[model samples]
Target: MDALQSSLLHQSALSYAYPLYRNLLDNSIVFLYHGPITPDLVVDILSLVENRLDDTGEDRRISKKLFNIMVESFSLGEDVERGHAVLLVRQLPYLYTVAIGRRIASSAVYQVKAFLDWVNTLSPEALREAYQRQLEKDDPRNLSLVGGVPAISILDLARKSHGILNYNFEYLNDSDTFFSLEARLQKTI
Candidate 1:
């Protein structure tokens, strides 16, 4: 009876939680949460990340910018999922990045690719101007649930911060694919 109990406990502990806990410790993860997206969850996460950024003694302006970008990213992901999504954030010395992945309807792939490509073609100044133009629109929410204003804002931020905006798509069987989008913010030294 003792051996069986010990085996069960050991297996359970080694399965999921242990590796995740180890990674969290090893990676200096300031914020990590993935599950259902609720208003409360978003609020709590913003507060936690805000405090963590404060502790790092970073510039107040940069910290605020990063926080707002994060909130918009979370909001975008939640909108995509309608309830659930995955948000992964990693903090490094000079680079802070967040990748939000969600299952998206495959029909939207071309549109997403086109949008990214168009943004890629713009110079920093041009991007900023385009973003302002987007902001001038009344309502830009499409069927995909990605708001134009926030998307343009994020792209503008990525450009101004000398960071990168990237994406990857993996087909999940048929009629759907997992879309992972990442935005990075590089600290200027």
Candidate 2:
């Protein structure tokens, strides 16, 4: 066999592969997407995640809830690329964690931070109230481009899962910020 072929079967190569394999078995990975964000791309990613969840025998109700949360959070961009983004879905023994990362304009960082801060402070009942309020109002200014209430679904999902939404914004030079949010869905869901 050629060196390239032989190397593929070598202990050294297998050693490097084993950790990732073991991790997959221990903590299921639901989905991962890292690219320029787009509407079609979001739909495609969700479809793939749905199929994988089915294979793993995840509950349909929980799957749907998770899917809704993902769609609301990830599908908010315009047709044009809004810079590169990353979405990672991991299933652990105690929780399912979704982490999304994207680049945002430096100016909007405070707005996002304030919004997240308000969300983080809300209790489950308070979140439900806020979500209801958003749904009741149908003003053009309040409507999200993707339909449904903006940020309401995220708050509802977090409340339902009894989960936490943690967000961070790191300054990337003068004009951009690297924004990331990690949401944890409890195993009970």
Candidate 3:
């Protein structure tokens, strides 16, 4: 009877996990990481992603854009040490999507949402101009500014992705919210 119960538990776990496994496969996920973001981990992830992009023979420009977006996205989180984040890279039919999800202080949710919304409305040229303006006004070297508010890195990501930045904020509690940002790069001919 105990053996049968153990088998049933294993089957149930498999049943729950199969769909998630299938979803990853269906999404053409090239890279997926869910953990504390560290400097060394970022380097390793970038190296793996670079190799994967090369192996797939992705267009040079698109790969570079994706790489830039990943770097910017990873750095957007001002308090990465305080939360574990998820980073996913997937290939779609027309473009490659790089997504980073992290938890942020609820106080900054409005600023992040506003910034992303404004960015989404900009044309490529306007986005580039915004990037330049922010670069001039803000110190890009200091990523942790304004108490976890994403500064120039967000603008750089918007420009690198050609304004194809998508973001969402989910309220987790009174003090923290889940922030998801996605940047898409068009596959060039």
Candidate 4:
């Protein structure tokens, strides 16, 4: 239902809950639910629902409502079925782009810092490798960018979207150090 609803979900209090939804989407800590939901099945269902969506500007309020409602109702279901509830919660990342689509990530050092800050909360090694791998397969010179990295690149994918990222902004200035961002990320996120 989370994925299906995110086929577009946005609007007011529902949006207020998107941060909580995103936190649940974080991969570091898991709920450890007991049930029949295999991770593969959750991924498959989420991809199916997400694939059916178009790239227009509209967002999914219905999905947000269902997600919010599920947070309450799913816990009430039998323990054996709780895994499916957990699976649904896992889909919130799929809806993140929709929730934050309009926010400006304009050319700001803090924007990259902000992005890296968010990445710091998750597994940094995983996030770094994911983008590096994507960049290896494409030519990034033609893409719309924020700090030279594609603003909405496929690297930002939440395991639900299917798009090829064709950019690589790994070229850091001479003054930039490997530990620079990582140091700040560790401190904040």
Compute the lDDT for candidate 1. 0.70
TM-score ranking of the models? 3, 1, 2, 4
Query: By TM-score, is 1 or 2 better?
Result: 1
Models sorted by lDDT, best on top: 3, 1, 2, 4
TM-score for each prediction?
0.77, 0.72, 0.83, 0.20
Tens digits of per-residue lDDT for model 2 on 9-82?
A: 67576676888667756667656677777777888888888998888898888787677767765743322445
Evaluate model 2: give its lDDT: 0.69
The local distance difference test score of each candidate is 0.70, 0.69, 0.79, 0.35
Q: Pull out the clashing pairs in model 2.
A: none
Task: Give the alpha carbon lDDT tens digit for every residue of 1-189 in model 3.
Answer: 699997886676767698888889998987888888878888998889889889989888888888888988888653556578889988889988888888888898877777778878888788888777777777556543433756577777777876568888899998888888888888863
Clashing pairs in 3: none
- Expressed as tens digits, the lDDT of each residue in 103-174 for candidate 4 is 121334455555544544545456667666756755566544444334334234322122211111232344
RMSD of 3: 4.8
What TM-score would candidate 3 get against the native?
Answer: 0.83
Q: At residue 54, what lDDT does model 2 achieve? A: 89
Q: Whose lDDT is greatest here?
A: 3
Q: So what's the TM-score on candidate 2?
A: 0.72
Top model number, TM-score: 3
Query: Model 1 segments beyond 4 Å from truth?
Result: 1-14, 25-28, 80-83, 140-161
